[model samples]
Target chain A: MRTVDPAKREAKRLQILAAAARCFARKGFGQTRTADICAEAGMSPGNLFYYFGSKQDIFAAVVEQDGVDTEALFAGLSAAEPWDALTRFFDLVVDLAADADYARLALEISAQAHRDERIAALVAANDRSVRSGLADLVARATGAGRIDPGLDPTTTATWLATLVDGLFNRVAVDAGFAPERERESLHLILARLLRHEAQPES
Target chain B: MRTVDPAKREAKRLQILAAAARCFARKGFGQTRTADICAEAGMSPGNLFYYFGSKQDIFAAVVEQDGVDTEALFAGLSAAEPWDALTRFFDLVVDLAADADYARLALEISAQAHRDERIAALVAANDRSVRSGLADLVARATGAGRIDPGLDPTTTATWLATLVDGLFNRVAVDAGFAPERERESLHLILARLLRHEAQPES
Candidate 1:
């Protein structure tokens, strides 16, 4: 019997997903063939299937990986103050947006979601994860009297999530938009939206 | 000498673009064939080519049409108070978002822009027009003392544009998000972001 190292197998799966992201971003979801992904990942076609069943499966994995990343992001912020946690999350968003391929891949995934039910559901789950995360923070902040009570937590979180989604779209759509410079204004907008006093941008 | 009726030509062009939009939204830009657009438009393939040289050309026209629509939208809003104009513009956005095909087509166009330079330039132009319209309103509002003075008009406009971009994306990505119901929260978010009093959701 051949023994497969579980950790090694998992790492290889991540490696394929990373390569697939690049292919999808450059050629779009429909234009990219499975062979292109295998080529990008520097693996044989047989090796690629060992990790993902097909192209659709790989795409779903990418979408799920995004969900996992969001969960990890929120998990790390669990101990921080609600408002500060949000601040850190937005900061991380800017950091992620700094990578053009990641931002482009996000845009591609959104387009795919529009066409595929499975992707749409996956993206929806990721969005729900984000909104729920924001909602939790908003509830905590409102309870602690850190922000305004004029809006409910879920709605506020939804709109905040909208801003985050829009931030990524802006990065993909506007070449001239520099995410680093917008960080200050993003802070200002979030502060105002939450009705909390904002620390002046540095 | 052969001559064409300009008005009729324009009408047919619009007809073809609308059909193309439907096909692109349904199948995505890459997967959509010219014949599909022709069938959707209810015209012969030759007639379709008379209006647009290639699939790429028709896509560009669709993008340009979006810019024209934006310009028309802002021009129509010219007489209103700056803040009211901004608010009304967002309301119009929500109204448009109610159209699923239009929203999906927008996602397709944004995805196309990421892959094609021609589309990118056109999309950027549309984005700039939106930002400028919002900036013009923001500048006037600040001048009229209608909002906070902490942020510049351009930056405020950019973020506001980001929110608009994000709103469309939310519609595309989140099935449960109803644009009609979001009006009140959107207004509230805008009010908070701009430091204006929010009108209660009706």
Candidate 2:
């Protein structure tokens, strides 16, 4: 057998994850099969197995990939104003929610996370990362005295993260609920929470 | 057959709903069978069918029963001291979260509400009722000058309701996340949001 190229292996892994995400989004985790993923990826069962050993592995990889992509989207933005950063975060989340397939996948993962320990742990880890990142941003803003020092950054971060999750679920269920309205409401809420006195410098 | 008594029929309907709630709590909506509900109720499947045409019907009844119970729980409460009413609301929610079986049932319904239109409508109706009740409370509170009059009662009520939902989900996922701790934080957050000047009445 020829040696597998590293770049080719990485590409195949991503391909399998994308296909698996689509399958999971459509049929749900319980109904989806490895064969279905293989067909979706246009790859043989052996090739699919070469990248992910099992269905759970494929799921974990998909979640990991989502986290990586989200992190990259928000990376290297230290110079931006606090309000701008918050607005960017809300816009990114709304864009994610706009995709029906992605939203379904997220709901499936959340439902499964309730019953499965491994999935719950994965979700918890991902949630912690996001919360910590947000807390860091809050802390920086606090240092600049943009937010009240009395408020706990970590708790506020957790609350904001929870709001994001709730907003995503709402968007998934209610088609009439406009993301623009939500984004505006969130900006106002964040401004109030942060005690921002000046007009947001867009 | 003997003439059916209206009161007795209503009682039986309530009984059936209770049994269905238990079954849904144990096995979830998707996993629960009509037979499972019959077994839970110690009745024949035919009897269960007479009471509810299908599993979905029984699920609907369970939700309707919950709505009635919640309404009764909040009945006769004037919106006088909306902040106090709001605190009481959170306390009641915390108590409900303490009931493990009910908490599971709520989460199951919430998850199913995402995929099923019938369930979604039922949940939305329930949400609307609660929000209106909360708005009444908020209006009274605003009238008493307890909370900031600048904030719209409906919007504040909606936000409060969403906060409870987020807190309940967190409590379900992490047993260590104490409802009491979050309740304290909620009180603080609400005080700030409402711009309460005096110390919150315990």
Candidate 3:
């Protein structure tokens, strides 16, 4: 038997996922074939099957990877000042919304989540993870007098998450949305929503 | 020769559309069969086909009817005081969002819009109609000094529409999100966004 390197195997798996993401984004999950993913990944069908048992498995992995990425992002932000961290979070959302492929993939996953119970569970878990992270930041900001103390942290966080969801949907729907151009309005809306008084330095 | 009464014909068409709406909302567009719609409408396949050429035509009509309903709604609200009309608009959104079937159907349509250019064009046209109505309200309010003069009506209207889109999405994704319960918060957020200082008449 040939010796298998775990790290190399993991890398190969990630390569497949990245390719799958592109294919799913371009064609949506139902229309995308595993062969398409293999071609995108520059691998044979056998090699692709060795990593993911089926297309469904590959799609699930893609959504699971989003949860992992979200957690990692929040963990990094948790150490920063709460207000700054929240600001950074919205800025990051704008960046993600600006990426057409990422926005389309997010919409595709959300659409699939509606029809598939397993996918819904995964999406709900990912949503919870995001909302929990946001709630923590909201709590910290309120406690530090950086935001309105009267606001419920969890509800505020959920709305914040909803705003990001809407942003992604706008990118997919509106041809002229221009996420980057809307950054100022987004910041202003956030400040108003949170009752934050911070002004950008001149 | 058999005669078709225009009024009766229109009524039957609406009945079919309403039934189709329920089926699409429950099973989504792809899974919903014309047989299911015919059964739901209490008609035979021949009767259903007489009204609609195919399932695709029926779906298109369903979406087009939504645009018609939306236009009629805005036309009714257009005469009200701008700010009051805007407030009523959000209130109606809460009502629609509270309807599980309506919210789900909206999501299904949006998902389909992503895959079909024709559907996308219809959805986009509906969206533009909505945003234009909202911008008109915003402009009137600004002129009347009911909202912040600094805010561009078109952009403000777009964000307001975005917020409502987010609201519908929240209902779909978050089982705990109660649209009726969130009314006050939504009002507060809108007031703050528009810099309106009006308080509810106590």
User: What is candidate 3's lDDT per residue for B1-202, written digit by digit as tens?
Assistant: 7599989999999999999999988887778899999999999999999999998889889999999999998999988999899999999999999998898888778777777888888888888888999999999988888887878999998898888788877877777889999898777677767864422211
State the lDDT of candidate 1 residue by residue for B1-202, as single tens digits.
7487999999999999999999998899988999999999999999898888999999999999999999999999999998889899999999988889998898899989988999999999999999999999998887887777766888888999898888889998888899999998787677767754421111
TM-score, chain B, each candidate:
0.95, 0.88, 0.96
Sorted on DockQ, best first, the list reads 1, 3, 2
Which lDDT value does model 1 have at A162?
84
* C-alpha lDDT of residue A191 in model 2: 63
Instruction: Show model 3 residue runs off by greater than 4 Å.
Output: A196-202, B196-202
Please provide TM-scores, in order, for all candidate models, with all chains considered together. 0.96, 0.84, 0.92
Candidate 2 C-alpha lDDT tens digits along B1-202: 8677989988888888888888877666767788888888888988777778889888977877777877876684553355677778878887886776776677667666666788778877777787788888888888887766777887777666666566655654454566666767666666666664422221
* Clashing residue pairs found in predicted model 3: none
Model 3 has an lDDT value of 0.86
Candidate 1 Cα RMSD after full superposition onto the native fold (Å):
3.7
Clash pairs detected, candidate 2? B82-B141
The positional error of residue A173 in candidate 3, measured at the CA in angstroms, is 2.1
Please provide, for model 2 over A136-195, each residue's C-alpha lDDT reduced to its tens digit, 9 standing for 90 to 100: 778888888777677799888877776676665555444555556666655656666666
Candidate that would win on TM-score: 1
For model 1, the superposed segments whose C-alpha errors exceed 4 Å read A196-202, B196-202
**Predicted model with the maximum lDDT:** 1
Single out the weakest 10-residue window by summed lDDT for candidate 3 chain A.
A193-202
